[model samples]
Target: MDKTYLEINKQSWDEAAHRFFGRNPLPDYGPLAPSEDELNLFGDVTNLNVLEIGCGSGHSLRYMDQRNAGELWGLDLSKKQIEAAKTVLKNCHSPVHLFESPMEDNPGLPTNHFDIIFSIYALGWTTNLDKTFANVNQYLKKGGIFIFSWEHPIYNRVSNENSTLLFNKSYHEEGSYYHEAWSEPAVMQQYKISTYINTLINNGFKIERMIEDVRLTKEDIQRDSNRWYSYEKAKALPTSVIIKSQKL
Candidate 1:
């Protein structure tokens, strides 16, 4: 919704690779391992065309290479992120296409050309949901898969790192949820669970599986509990939701 704000994010992401990847050019899957493991539910990737929307820093791009999937493409609104991602892929001869484009208006890609599309924690940041969903549908081949993980709509209500947990309104609303991450303003859009499910269904996609959980690791509880997440609150409620869907 905020193009200028998102543009700021684009610039920030490009400049943060030193902070993100650091001495390790590749990311080490610590807590992220659990999240990455969820990709298995989408089934085998061998020879299947795949696209990763919001492929920040190309960490997912590197992960996709291990899947042996057919041609892989990653699209993001941040050209800075894409530039850093390309740098990360300098020596790796993989079939990965990294592009700087809005997901809703991606260029040079034909419709019904991909077998799987996956985005992580990035879809809700888009300005337009309907057009985004339509674009997802347009790119997937029949029976292709679409999966994404995002900050739970409930988690969007409160942005306080120091604020204690408190009950909020019903989990349906239209507004901006703000958070400070990597010193950049992260904004999320609120949508009911049904709105997300219906958007996919209306676009000729069927939900294959959905998981809403607050399962946190011991490390997450110990190190980043107060700042990034709350152990007690997460145990009481979900913080993230990951969904897998199939094009009908």
Candidate 2:
């Protein structure tokens, strides 16, 4: 079956939507709500406009709503997720705008318009980094914050390994990047780490914070059966990286 990353996300999210939204009113891969520490990532957003990509069930949306932010909006590729988010938003006092769009597609928000744009564990699935980040830049105000998190390259590499010490699948030896989907006729496409970073800088974003960690709990290991990736090795290498940047 011919499928894109968004399609895969939609399917998985649709199946898991109940479990996801049930666990938390708003759920993202990261913290349930934007805390003071997370707020630090964006300096100040008391009344600033916020845009979130891949906002599965409006976890961040509810958080921003509580803060009484100027305007809160979210975009995701999954209609089911959008529906789940709207249901959650019913209790929210602030207004929220939702849109269905893939990151590679134009999001239709005004350029230089948002105070913050953030995503978590979403960019890793993107087919085009340049187009994605470039479009993100178009929506941000000058000096706006862009905070996101992704599967750490190291973690991705290790996860592909059968063991922490050995690879389950071989990656390009020449440093070529690859994008892989979960479903049928699995094909991997070439990409590059440099391309991702360059895409940000080239799109007028400057990296301010880059945090990498292995970050698996004992439960996480048990849940995975400990045979998947070398969690022990991941202890030494990072499984994810959280980045805080600014539109310069």
The numbered model that scores best in TM-score is 1
lDDT of candidate 2 at residue 4, scale 0 to 100: 62
On residues 80-199, what C-alpha lDDT tens digit does candidate 1 reach at each position?
677877876565546777889877676677689998888877777676788889899989999889988776777646544454666455665675656456676655567877878988
Worst ten-residue run, lDDT, model 1?
Answer: 23-32
Clash list (residue pairs), candidate 1 = none
What C-alpha lDDT, on a 0 to 100 scale, does residue 159 get in candidate 2?
45
Error of 1 at 104 (Å): 2.2
- Give the poorly placed runs of model 1, Cα more than 4 Å off: 1-39, 158-164, 168-170, 177-186, 219-226
Task: Please report how far candidate 1 places residue 157 from its true position, in Å.
Answer: 2.3
In candidate 1, position 200 carries an lDDT of 88
Q: Candidate 2, 219: how far from true, in Å?
A: 8.8
Q: Tally clashes: model 1.
A: 0
* Per-residue C-alpha lDDT of model 2 across residues 1-248, encoded as one tens digit per residue: 12464575566556656655633222223321222343466555678899888777787778778777778888887678789888877777766888887777776777888998888766765656777888888899898888887655544454433433555444443232433333322223233345567778998999887765443667545433234344566666655556778999
Which candidate leads the pack in lDDT?
A: 1
Candidate models: Cα lDDT each = 0.69, 0.65
For residue 244, what is the lDDT in candidate 2? 77
